[model samples]
Target: MFVSTPRTEASILHADLDSFYASVEQRDDSSLRGRPVIVGGGVVLAASYEAKAFGIRTPMNGRDALRLCPQAVVVHPRFSAYSDASKAVFEIFRDTTPLVEGISIDEAFLDVGGLRRIAGPAADIGQRLRERVRDEVGLPITVGIASTKFLAKVASAVAKPDGLLLVPPGGELKFLHPLPVERLCGVGAVTARKLHDHGIRTIGEMADVGETVLVSMLGGGAGRHLHDLSWARDPRPVHVGRRRRSIGSQRALGRRPKSAEDIDAIVVGIVERLGKRLRAAHRVSRTVVLRMRFDDFTRATRSHTLYESTARNDAILGVARRLVAGATPMIGERGLTLIGLSLTNLENDDAVQLALPFDADANGALDVTIDSLRDRFGTAAVTRAVLLGRDQGMVVPMLPD
Candidate 1:
């Protein structure tokens, strides 16, 4: 490869961990290395590259996966271990650069433009980052460096399984034009099929066509977006944040089937935790979203947006319950595997007028009272009537209120 300094420099780096959960399994147990490993039995959580070679994929049914690679070893998910690994990897990212934007626990975008004088070029920083993660965390990670976040992400995908790739600033089109249209973000199976019908297969072909023509073929938003992306005109920045776009919690159920009462208790546990977090952070949300995964390896999401935002547990739970109830038929048909709740459309609690001091119904005083009591004593000290003497699903990652 001819490495050169173009008219402009590549300064954005996208770093992603490879097969995070399965890799963690390999790192801890020597027996799992060099062999195919599958995490999660009912549904695949993560599959090692060796297992992936045999066509095993995450979220696939374990039965189908075993049918493909019967020799593969299946391991239950240890979220605590995975969470610790994610934290360590993220710490390395923060140490590597202050301008780190975490997209997920396992991946981030690092802006290294101003660090050239201090930490060498972006390419050098990326290489050092990979070495540090591999040596310190005992995990293989891939990094891609480019002028734009989109290009950087693409470069990283091209250099997978512990590799580094740098796309020079002026040569982004040269690197992207020949790749399939599916490589572009937002081009799922349906959009790809539509493009395939139009005989447009690569980004270069998209670049050759006019945006107006594309609009005629694929509607306005998709047309304009794809046209700009084909020419490498992405201007979206890597956003850094404290409060996320959404806060959510999920629990996986094994093969055992549960009654409607069992499911409602699970919902209560999730909303109880989320409601406390929302108010503690001084935030309010207008949307309650329910995410469900079925035994058939399919997933569905239902959401309800309230006319007004609230941080009250009863308000949020009312909407969450309705959303879940609406999906009961699908749940019965597909069989339940995982359930989760997320609060979205969030804003500062002050968006609505703060209630007068000690107002119970309007400002959720009872909820606040419960929070204080739990803080003083243990969470088990106070409980809702419905949750009394029941074993709700464990709240992983999030502390109980």
Candidate 2:
């Protein structure tokens, strides 16, 4: 059974770029090699491996990161350059498999189940992928081959920077068991603390606790999800053509206490950007999700579903303002460390049968015209009143589609 399982597990491969954005920066700039590089201003967008060694991480405040790695060389992120590199790497991925599901700009799941005859084997494909990414794209990537998405992702994480790891099917338990519970997706700080209180410290310990107990402990949705992942039995397919349901952005404000007006301004900026993206995509969002992270790293998200889907900034910002108000009482003196805005429940405009009875076509047309101007001239050409001065001259971080 064990020998048969090893053969079955080699079909799924997860490819993850090493320290993607920072790596690109290091590769493009010869002077940045072997030194700590931190990208982004006001906050740490992404840090190089050297900076990471000093405990600097993404989404951290720039000041904190600088404090952590005093010798870190800070560089502004070049999204255009990163995008070009990503496109090249993805093109290589397509050459290897017809079924590649991108999880982010830096990582993807490739299903080479039917490529045995041509590609040789999963290990061969992984090696070729690493070589192509290195030789052609000028970047280092890590590849992990396993039977399931969960294990594949875990394997890739284990083989970071530039490496390859393969987990055989029957070896899932052995591969996963000793890992910290935090290694399991969705088990963030809060979840980890909750599980720790229950004496669950590792994936193996979580598995030993039984599914029924976990469900009772963490609620039906998260409990069942984590329990299954603890056993490395994910059944998700490597799907392609998966359109994103949400477009969102977040800014970290550090540990300082921000005034309500300050936070509102940030939210407005996010909503404005989100609205532009929606209009450009010709899609409307039916739901708005507001995520807030506090100084102590505790986070909360509140969402509201609109009666009608629209890409109008007025509509989205209006709801976002209300959601912020609702969350203000929770803010307290600790202040907000991070603010995020996301639009979800998305559908194409063609699917929108008609505009709302209360909405005027004039407003929709105006939005389309504005989007066209911004798209051509750039996002800063046209801006809302709330976003003015709040622009901070910092470019938003781009996420992988």
Candidate 3:
């Protein structure tokens, strides 16, 4: 006689801080308690739950946010304070489990599979983790427990604003099916529109439509991706110390109109910073992408793949400028509000063929020299003429490289 073994229990916990930046502000200032707070003047960086109740959201124009919540208190971002709070919260996460995988400064996926023998059930562990974050860090955090990372992330999203939810081991589909199709990963605005047009309003509905039809509608990769997730088939583990695949930075250009020169300068500043970061991480990129957000809240992206991977700032900037110039027509029609840059298709520097004397990156020597100076002195020790006398923009905190 043959017997079937029991499946693994739900042990993945996705913990995400509740309105991280806004919560930090409320925690530090008693007077701000229960008040609608928006933490940015130009673009809404973060909005407290109180503010969110009034339809305020991040990346929305601050003026529009104020129009929505007339009583909302506007405050400039304190990136340093948010960073400190994130560090403190991460410390708490590390103390909870050695199997913590940080997704970002404000969120992480923790695997507590074997810890149940000592720490009790995954649900209990998640509850305790939330309590610890609340009591120690003085920040509200939501935790989702499930057998898979995808389900855990979805559960956390559903249980937002300091809440916890668990999808029992055999009940993944029951918990997932009723949710809207937009809940699935990779189902963005465009994909969601397509799914909705097909009358696939829920995860269960999408699943019933079957993979073949989905593939035709959403293309091969994305169609297959959603089909797998609808039935809770994600196999990604909580990766610890994961290296980032891409390094990117963006500047929020306020409602004010920007000239082509102004946009180019911002692109240069962003690329300069990203280049230094890429080299510092000992990584090279083969693709450069330029992202633009319009006043109408729509976004467009253009990318160019290089003949070879390189981390030289000038080389990356050249590609970025070309991408931006190509998008110039769209920017003119829509009116640009934000511009960002990303270097992707990354590989370890060790994989790069050593440059010969004749084929070396012309700026490679200068790039390394400037990086060294910045490391010994400060980042401000080196400067580019285009970036000079311009706001470099705030350095948003990120997970470990």
Candidate 4:
């Protein structure tokens, strides 16, 4: 096994942007500061710290969010702007350490173990990182410093909305045990509910249980996984290579009203292009995520994960189209201003897969033929029948994480 350096100091840092979309709104428009700002009018993409004070949170339905905070100002998403900010901040993260793991567009784990002499202590480095993001990117970021990834993430969560927290080495348990069991990564609402019913509300309480018992409670793998996390035993490193967990593309639509056929065409266009890109990367993804923002400035995401991974466009598009169709009612209620798709839970081409079935006509041979034509001639050389003259969306290059 590969062993890392001794965890004598809190060397891992988890830096996360604060209410990223909403923060950008506040940063650009001075009038929005100190006010409840909601990004995404139909679904809550992000809520400013001010709106959060009113019990507003992200991914909440826009209608419900407005009901909670009626005075909130909602804005449509600017993907280009958010993408630019993410690139700039990630540049800072790369500059901080070569070993930077980007968890999402807005958060990363930075390993600064060997930079003590050059960059001072880890906590100090974390503070300086937050400052750089605020000063350079015009965004507020919170950072957490600890000996392990799990503890670092928890520390950042505890110190939210532009705060820096450091969990001292050897004091990880002291800091972690008091927190709720839900603080453990991967423990969602259902998992937490199960744990709560069993009287395991806090990490400390959960840690007191035997591993075998935890396995019995949360299934073997999850039980052991949570058991280790509750004990602050995360050994994962800040994986280098900036491998993004998902690859996505989106296009912004103006306030023009679109018919269901028009929307479906955009979806088809996006998926056809994205599928080509996925195969080029020599990877297969299990999840197809559909993200939409309505003219009402509300956003919502629907994702479907396939049991077996596949790189074929037809297979991924099949899943993508279904997710869009399922959201049709919501689309009718709110006019969509943006349409996007992301492929997640990726795996290597050689990974083992289940016996999920696909139509025999949807073969890699045909996909390879189309891709070859597109490569030699250009994307416009081979067009899906649905995208012809239908205002197919642009495929802009996403800024590197």
Candidate 5:
């Protein structure tokens, strides 16, 4: 008789770059190494471990961050440099395993199952990955290994700033139950405070309260979600080459009031950038969304859906302009501090029917020509008249298609 045995050793690995922007700064300049570094002039985009030791954090106002650490070195962001470094690190990740799922530009989940015969244990593979990244890409990365994706992600967060950890099989609960409820997935500020108020402070305590009780306290969906996470019941696989659901970009404008023309130019620049990215990824979207943030820290969104999907800038821009016009009344009421644009309901270009030659849009050819020129010369080779002398904002980094 032939018998089959299930394999259950921990094989999922989560790899994350530590303080990505700040690490890049320390790597490139020797003077910045071992010193507190801050990466942005207006908002604190990233802070080095040295700076974090002084109670500094990201997204804090640069002025207030200086108050925390007066000697911290603040540098203007160089998007080009950070983009290049991210590409280099991802190349190393793909070299390690074929099953790499990128969560963002700075982190990914890798499945290394069924490779023990060729590559030894999963822990050995993770250690080698860390070594290669440090030697080749010149950056520090932390890695966590566990049986499930959720546990692996939590383990990585626990072991950060250049460290590695692995949770062995048959010991998942002993390791998980001791952690705070905040360490579990789907437990944000509101959920954590609610759990604390109910005298459930730890994952073990939450588990003891029973699912029926939890469901009564929190809503049905959230209560069920937290209960399952308390037991580490995740079954998600590490997917490779997954396409992004939507693509978008945004810019922060100062508090100083400006005319409507200024806002219009910013919208044009954002639309052009997003359209380029959409076409480059070979995807088209049917819905265009406009997101705004006011000086009072309140936010609002407006969207318009088109009859057909398209990747042309003019087509997307037409929809975006109408959305902005519709929200102009709200913008006038609240002072605008930030504005963003997003494309959703995405699909592959080949999924749509092609237009006949006689009915083809001229903008399609123009898009191709501009993309080629930017590829050969530079992104600045061609630009709209309105954006010629304007600060078009930085191009945010994203995962590869």
Candidate 6:
């Protein structure tokens, strides 16, 4: 674990949108102003700040969000529009600095260390970036300026919803010490509860526990990680040209007890779509991961590494089916409510080796042919039988990629 040393020089900047999807909807339709807005049907995909004030959040049930804010307006997702807006905002970042590392569609870490003479100081650059995004893209963005990537991220989180924050040199500890322990990266509910039980509720308290005690309490990796962050220490550089390493999808089925057949069908649909995306990107995945959320909200993940990397839908779906089967006992006891699929261990298309001798290439060839057809036509032109009538439509625009 490494703690970042505060420096007078600010180079890294993190930019993030404020209630991105909801904000976009509000911007497009002025009538939604000051009213709660929910952006999904089955799930409360994204909620406006107004809805959030009413205790609504993402991954929540749409029905519950409506109950919280009965006057809230619901809207379906607009992916193409969001993607266009993202491209426009990213263009602004690129214009300012060449070393912009995108974390998601709406957030990125910009390294402007080499732009002092040309683009002014980091603080000024951040201000300009925010204004540009608002004026050109019609969305509000918050920015955090710091000397390191971790501090920049923390700074951005602190200054959200159309705000800007700068952590000056030698002020890192002062800014971090009083924050809740749960605010630290990787300190989820489980870790926060554990820390609170030990009377370590704040970052400063965690720091006082010392590295040795944290290691003993939280185990080597997690303990060391918390200890380092407690001191406002992070050394990750803002690197450019970072490519996505995985493609995945998840669906929340609320508290409903879906049957094994239903779960299998959903998992198959997710894997099929994900495999198509992998092939579109000219990549192959050697690992498949299955994530499940039970009706009681307890979550578990199972993963399997394939004998070789491949982008075929059948191969990926086969592994996913096996993972779902293995989790059947747990599902029987708790009842499954949500399912997810992710393909990892990715490699470039050129890196994939052909299948071994005696294996039929028909399936692979058919997958490629299907992909080409979909590329020429639309995504709707090709759909799995399970997904044919499942036109719930996109509930909310995901963070643009």
Q: What is the lDDT of residue 82 in candidate 5?
A: 86
lDDT by residue for model 6 (316-387), tens? 989999998998999999987778988888898787777665667733888888888888997777777876
Which scores greater on TM-score, model 3 or model 6?
6
| After superposition, candidate 6 runs with Cα above 4 Å error | 1-8, 391-401
Q: How close is candidate 2 to the true structure, as a TM-score?
A: 0.90
* Of candidates 6 and 3, the better by lDDT: 3
What's the TM-score of each model vs. the native? 0.84, 0.90, 0.91, 0.74, 0.90, 0.93
lDDT of 4: 0.84
lDDT of 4 by residue, 1-401 (tens): 22335466799999999998888889999999999999875568889999999899877778889998889999987877888889999999989888787787899888899999998999889989988998999999999999988899999999997999999988999999999988999899889999899998999999998798899988999999999998999877767664456888886766678888887787788777777877787778889999999977878999998877877888888998899889999988888888899999987676655453455654476888899999999878988888887766433334342
- Model 3 scores a TM of 0.91
| Cα misplacement distance, residue 141 of candidate 1 (Å) | 0.8
Local lDDT at 45 for model 2: 80
Minimal lDDT window, size 10, model 4 = 392-401
Task: Please tell me which model should have the higher TM-score, number 2 or number 3.
Answer: 3
- Candidate 1: 10-residue stretch with minimal lDDT: 1-10
By summed lDDT, which 10 consecutive residues of candidate 2 come out lowest? 1-10
Number of clashing residue pairs in every model? 0, 0, 0, 4, 0, 4
Candidate achieving higher TM-score, 1 or 3: 3
lDDT of 6: 0.82
Residue 400 displacement in candidate 1 (angstroms)? 15
Q: On a 0 to 100 scale, what is the lDDT of residue 191 in model 4? A: 93
Per-model RMSD to reference: 5.0, 3.9, 3.9, 7.1, 3.8, 3.0
What is the per-residue lDDT of model 2 for residues 11-93, given as tens digits with 9 covering 90 to 100?
88889998888999999999999999999877788899999999999877789899998999999889889888988999999
Q: In angstroms, give how far residue 4 of model 1 lies from its true place.
A: 24
TM-score of 1: 0.84
Specify the highest-lDDT model's number. Answer: 3
lDDT of 1 by residue, 243-337 (tens): 56678988787668978988999899999989988888888998999999999867899998998888999989999889989999998888898
